[model samples]
Target: MSCFEILDPAFGRFVLGNAALKQLATGFDWVEGPVWFGDAGCLLFSDIPNDKILRYTPGVGISTYRAPSNYSNGHTRDRQGRLVSCEHGTRRVTRTELDGSITVIADSYQGKSLNSPNDVVVKSDGSIWFTDPHYGIGSNYEGFAADQELPCNVYRIDPDGTIEAVLTDFNCPNGLAFSPDETLLYVADTGRMYQDDPAHIRRFSMESGRPKSLGIFHTIAPGKGDGIRCDMDGNLWSSAGDGVHCIAPDGHLMGKILVPEKVSNICFGGRAKHQLYITATTSLYAITLNRVGAQTP
Candidate 1:
């Protein structure tokens, strides 16, 4: 029952062996994105099919942060502490300013509408990065269906409002994150669509603040993974069909945290930033861990 046996080697010194998973809330169609707001002391996550964003805290329980959330899929905070979100319904990326107004980041490129904005992350330089897939347009359940007019690609919205395609050739890019040092970028390709053999997570070498080389990082043996994040030590914590998998920075399979439901996304928050908040399908769960997430970089 040692904590080291339950978490990645990088996290062995952090999570207690006996820490128990705590259920926070339930009753949603599907939960996907999760972002922690330390300033507000709450965790915000998406219930995609429900078209809503929900907030959870230790005392107040669950509350609707935003209804009709444009079927948002993924979310993160900019360095300025603004909420940035990826919208499936609109096939665009947006930001919520402090003054409570929405600014569309990217809805189209080269006069073509994006397929679906799935997951998002922001860099220290105010560049917005996101994944575009066809999940939103594959059916009418999560958003309006339409012919996909764009390739499944990763895009970067520069600080000056210029949009640039960062990566392409992905079949289904679902989740993404940067290594603690920002030298490597990891993205999950659920690949549930084409390509009989799909990659779970792919790593790209970053040069001059851009991705220059691409390689397969790790592929889950059975099911798929999504919404990956890194710890202070560079271990990737990814959501899986079974639960959560922690892979070492050296591509070693570390350990896992088991949950009753399929987890879609996760974030670190709480008093010491040691709390791991998980957005499982239809439910939200958390557990105290021994490590802290990598600060946005």
Candidate 2:
């Protein structure tokens, strides 16, 4: 009964073979984003179809952080420890201020409405990066059903409040993360969700405000790449239909942590930032790992 499926020797050393996988909570409708707040001693995740954000504290169990969450999908914390989120129902990105107020990061570009903000990450420099896809608008289950008005792409919100489409040619951008030093960006395209499209992750070098594409990093088959994160050693951890896949810094599949449900997102948290929190269909699960995320708690 190993907790991990080690596909590479390096990954065997990366994950504890005996560390048990724990299900923290259940009974949610489609959990997608999971972010750990070490300062608050709790983990926050979205139950998208329910349009709510649930907080899971070790002793207190699960509670509502925010109801009517605008169908938030992805979340991350800025360097200042503020909450940055992507709202699928609202088709916009938002930031929760210290005073508990919400600031709109971006909802439109060039006078055109965004499709739906999906996954997001914050750079050390305070710039906000997020994916825009039509998944939310494709139906009324997770969001208000409406017509899409923009291409499926990834965007960057500048520190000064300017918004620009950094990657414009995605079939369906779903997940994104930065390399350990912020020199490289990894974005996943789950085009396979439709018409046998390529389900792969792409790499880019961040330069000149418009990053240069390094090319496809890895092509996933029989599954698709969803929410993703980078470890301190620069390995990319991605969500798949089967479980969580760990790919090497050089784009080789290293290993996987198999979950019973389809995994949507992942984050590194817990007291030591060595806990890998996973968001699956209707549950939140965690396992202790020997690695740390690129961003610290």
Candidate 3:
């Protein structure tokens, strides 16, 4: 049985035949928000229902990075190499400073409490962008069930501490990433909870730090995309029900990486950034590829 499912001939050059998908860890209710810390040689991810953050090292195995993590769901590193996280329990975005202190990034917009912050990404200019959906507060499984105070929207926090809602038309914005050159922003909308809503990824053109919508980029079938990342070649790797779907820059489905569990999120990590780390329902998986992830810190 082959793990690779080549849908397009172009995907052949991106995968390595010698590479195998390895399950790094398991025994979690749900896992998401994987971020690679190259400086520390570790990968930190959230076990949402468990309310803990787990760290994985190549040889050391899995360990608890942080417990009672406020139900964090997504994470990324800032330009300073600090950890930026989206917390579902607290319904806010936060940053873990180098000195071991936690700083609140954003919790509200225009005096109204925000929904749960799902996924986040940092720009080269130090801006923090994230998606706020009601998923976290909609149930007691992943977070404290509560009423949503604001609409699901995407927001950006400026380096100087000002926060603004950047996009407001998503049914539920889940994952997000930037192109290698930072010219394009790809965001996943997993609003399948509502009948008739299509599960898709939307592309936005970035201009002077603002996004101009380019409409639906691609739609995922067999399940929806919850998290997404981009490789150096501008190919977007998205977490799907069947596994992981690779979409080209022109919005074409290139291929799929089959996994035993449904993938929730992914990040490019490992020494040379040639490895793709995936967070699925109950396990963490990784596979080496011929491509390098887009440079982001």
Best by TM-score: 3
Ranking by lDDT: 3, 2, 1
Candidate 3 residue pairs that clash: none
C-alpha local distance difference test of each model:
0.85, 0.90, 0.92
Cα TM-score per model: 0.95, 0.97, 0.98
Number of backbone-clashing residue pairs for each candidate, in the order shown: 2, 0, 0
Ranking by TM-score: 3, 2, 1
Kindly list the per-residue Cα lDDT of model 1 for residues 50-131, writing each as its tens digit. 9999888779999999999999999999999999999999989999999999999899999999998999988878888899
Cα error, candidate 1, residue 18 (Å) = 2.4
Q: Could you tell which candidate, 1 or 2, scores higher by lDDT?
A: 2
| Residues 37-78, model 3: lDDT tens digits | 998999999999999999999999999999989999999998
**Which ten contiguous residues of candidate 3 have the minimum total lDDT?**
191-200
